[model samples]
Target: MNTIGSWQNHAISLGLPPNTPVKKQIDEFIRRWDNFR
Candidate 1:
């Protein structure tokens, strides 16, 4: 349900580097956020 723009914003907010691929960023972001819960 995430749009590209919002996905990128979430990735950035998660402190993930922009140089990586979006798929990777999303996966990592999910992992990190899950751990935080």
Candidate 2:
């Protein structure tokens, strides 16, 4: 079965621009999520 990778998956689907401020926030979140490990 296929599964979504992460928020970045949805972000990619939505065609969010990499330079957008909101995308920057999500990028920060992904960074924090990794640091939690």
Candidate 3:
């Protein structure tokens, strides 16, 4: 899955809205994953 999709999944797993400001947390997670890659 793409970053945005994976982010959405992370947010959903956390019971957050897909577009919630907390989605920033998901974006951070994606950033970390990208950095690791």
Candidate that would win on TM-score: 1
Clashing residue pairs found in predicted model 3: none
Can you write out model 3's per-residue Cα lDDT over 1-37, one digit (the tens) per residue? 3455665566776566776565577576678789999
**Candidate 3 lDDT trough over 10 residues, lowest sum:** 1-10
- Candidate 1 regions exceeding 4 Å error are 1-18
- lDDT (Cα, tens digit) per residue for candidate 1, span 1-37: 3455665566666676656677898688679789999
TM-score (all chains, Cα) for each model: 0.49, 0.44, 0.41
Off by over 4 Å in 2: 1-20
Q: Which candidate, 1 or 3, has the higher TM-score?
A: 1
Give one digit per residue, the lDDT tens place, for model 2 in 1-37. Answer: 1154555554554466444465675676678679998
Q: How do the candidates rank by lDDT, highest first?
A: 1, 3, 2
- Against the reference, the lDDT scores of all candidates come to 0.70, 0.58, 0.66
Query: In terms of lDDT, which candidate is strongest?
Result: 1
